[model samples]
Target: MRIGLFPSANYSAKKDIGPMKQMGDSHVISDVLALGKGVAGSQQVLCLDGASILLRKLSLDSISKVEYENNHFCFGVHFLLEGNYSFVSTESKSRLNITSGSYNLVQWPKTNGVEKLKGREYTSIEVFFTQEFLEDLLGTEYNSAFEKFDNTLVDKPKYLWNEMKPIPGRLRLLLLDILHCSYTGIARTNFIESQIRCLLIEVFLGKENGMEQIGGEATLSTLDKEAIDEVVSYIKQNLKRKLTIKELSEVAGFNTTKLKSCFKKVHQTTIFKFITQLRMEKARLLVLEENYTVAQASYEVGYSNPQHFTVAFKKTMGYLPSLLLTNLS
Candidate 1:
């Protein structure tokens, strides 16, 4: 199941490579592709009709490197859930450091790069789409919304590369859901395809809403920046407590108005929104990763009523907490 571009010499000889021949679709075939020997952990590869999604939670005990040379023209979005890696591009002589809490979108071209994975555990999701599939999905006006790479297309770049953007709150939740999904057979296929469609929409259309351009005239002083960072740390540490802007302002040593404006300027989101995002993220992690009951998680995150918590969780995460529990069970 090796893709022609990413060749590996470390495949287990005992594993049956011929199983890939029985895979009926391209998505399934791509999912089973050998990722080399350094990855050891749970993996789920879903081959949808239009796209292929690979979710891996693995440990890299040794340095793993992959080099590509002018391979297929496809669009890929890689989500780095945990761990860090560095990429050195031979073509541009550029180095990109991909860290946890960030995602990278690239229009892979005829280029060469070395990916150096540190010896640690990593969780990641990668979605790949062919040119025809993307063209069909994006339609004629794609050029206006997406910038090209390397002048590949006559009209514009067929794909766009967005390096190291913070994952939006909803998209993060969706990725968690995909990772925890328990369905199988046709239900699993349909669920994955739907998730991929939503993910693509979030990446293409929802970029502007989540990404803040941090340059130009608006800037924060070093003292103010440190204050905002402290406030963020405080909020995360005290999620169970009822947080108010006034209390946060006191911590930052600023008035309420200045506190709100400065916090938004530094974090690219308002204080309340940031707090809510953190609370929801923590609550979900507790329920899904730590096996906390719904009521316990809700109360731990400062919800007085379970019903109220359910409403807020559904609104913020686009699904009920019970769904996560059900998948976990």
Candidate 2:
């Protein structure tokens, strides 16, 4: 399917943005959309196994609203990284405010719209996942959340997850990492693939936990948030070893009580619970991908007793490790 970007209201006749092209071991496409006066924008697109990403940047001296043929598209996240714009759905008569440092989930059917920009420049990244891709990733776990998006075409377009939310600090960092990625060739693909998966998990898991990125999170100082982020990095690197909240507090230069509060504020989970989830995830990969036995996987993730690991695995994954092994084809 082709998607078009137009500089004016004549978008009803504008055609394709061109086909996605692949090179070597990765798929990426780069293009420039020239709208009206001084409104030339550069865009980069990357294709994964089941989803596509679009990173767009534009600068203008005098701005005019740009229209787009919002044909049938995949469900996705819209990350507005720079400037400000509001999308006015022509048919639905609904307006979506897009501002710098804000992100939201967009699931819409075929509807054309005008993008009204409020700043000198605009920069954004969109990650769209096919229905098949979402279903395969979600499995039965997110069945209820998955039902939020409607595939049916309607004369008036509607947004499934319409709340405009501020982008979390962690996700902001990840977006910059992708934008500033310096890797070459296949390593670039691997880097972006891993980053995308982590990003998707953060978004989806937040929904599963019934947690919103509350305004209280802004109460954390920049230095404190960075300190907490560093602690999380440390835990992941040392997951196989014994870890303690006291040690993590020292790492963050906060006392145990402050450490607990700040960590939960930033991550929405306790430190120890986060560690257990990480360990179980690692053990799952070891068993399913590396063919490790359940006992070995358990030991590798820092569990001394396989029985305890089995119980934890069922709680996290909703099934026994041995069962997953036996069922693998």
Candidate 3:
């Protein structure tokens, strides 16, 4: 049976909690209505009842007055909410210099500077599952399985080293559905269960942990940036050479897994796609500039068979080589 275990809120049966208010020295927002205004510098993860959640950033200095306001979206568990939140820093800096994609947890230190953000819209849906809930799933084998899961997530609080941006359209819709079922008090339907499982798979397996380009932007880590530069130079210098995962990994001096991940982080696509795109672009130029025949260009670009070349070119460029020539002519 599918179930949602989430944070509790201070929102009452009656009375409007209104938009989140900022208070104290830490410029953090909470589901104050449901979770109550946390004591300043509280470290615990507050659980709010029901699933609906919304949060806006607030300045801790003047939160008691509610005078300051800032522009930001309200995104969280079981709801689509957006609004402005504000807090002005008093010590030295007039405004707190938080950038996009910034997040903090109980353990991890907050990463500073705009470079970490890369201008992406920051949003996250925190999902909490109790050990008891997981134990129920494993039944007789629950103990061992639960231990494994716990070990993996033990460092979860600080695991936000990289942001998981949601993909446009498809994945976002999937998240919306999950939140809807969560707050609507609806039973976990079979279809919804599949969707939830799909999300989990994406998180566990998808490149960059299935992070999509929120606002079509990303923040690259230093390791990712270095790996990207190495991979790009290798591809450009050896476009006509046969390429493989191992070779690419070596060129980047990163393990195969890390190379693939860094490629996705910087380029927002896989190495295979990057190489294929480069080859296809070069082939198009050869056809346009040198007037090479499809067969000639195909072999010159490293494809053994003209048919395979045509298939690859069409898949990437959405036009047959001949058609590309026709358009150019």
Predicted structure with the largest lDDT when compared to the true one: 2
lDDT of each: 0.66, 0.68, 0.43
Q: Per-residue lDDT for 134-250 in model 1, tens only?
A: 667768745644543443632211224343555555677678777666776566667777887778766765644322232222677879877876887688779999999889999
Q: What is the lDDT of candidate 3?
A: 0.43
The parts of candidate 2 lying over 4 Å away from their true place are: 2-26, 147-154, 207-329
Candidate 3 accuracy as TM-score: 0.36
Winner by TM-score: 1
For every model in order, what is the number of clashing pairs?
A: 2, 0, 20
Between candidates 1 and 3, which one is better according to lDDT? 1
Candidate 1: TM-score? 0.68
Could you give the candidate ranking by lDDT, starting with the highest? 2, 1, 3
- How many clashes show up in model 2? 0
Lowest-sum lDDT 10-residue window in model 1: 1-10
> Candidate 2 lDDT, tens digit per residue, 202-299?
67655522234332244777798779868976887798899998899999999999999987765556788778876876787677657888899899
Candidate 3 lDDT over residue span 1-329, tens digit each = 11232111221223444654443212223344332342122211222221122222222222222221111111122111111122232222232222222221111111111101111112233333334433443356555322322233221123222332323223443554443332211233334445644654454335443323232454667676766666776787788788899998887788998888777765556778777876876677577657788788887778988899999988876667788556455
> How much is 34 displaced in model 3, in angstroms?
66
User: How much does candidate 2 score in TM-score?
Assistant: 0.54
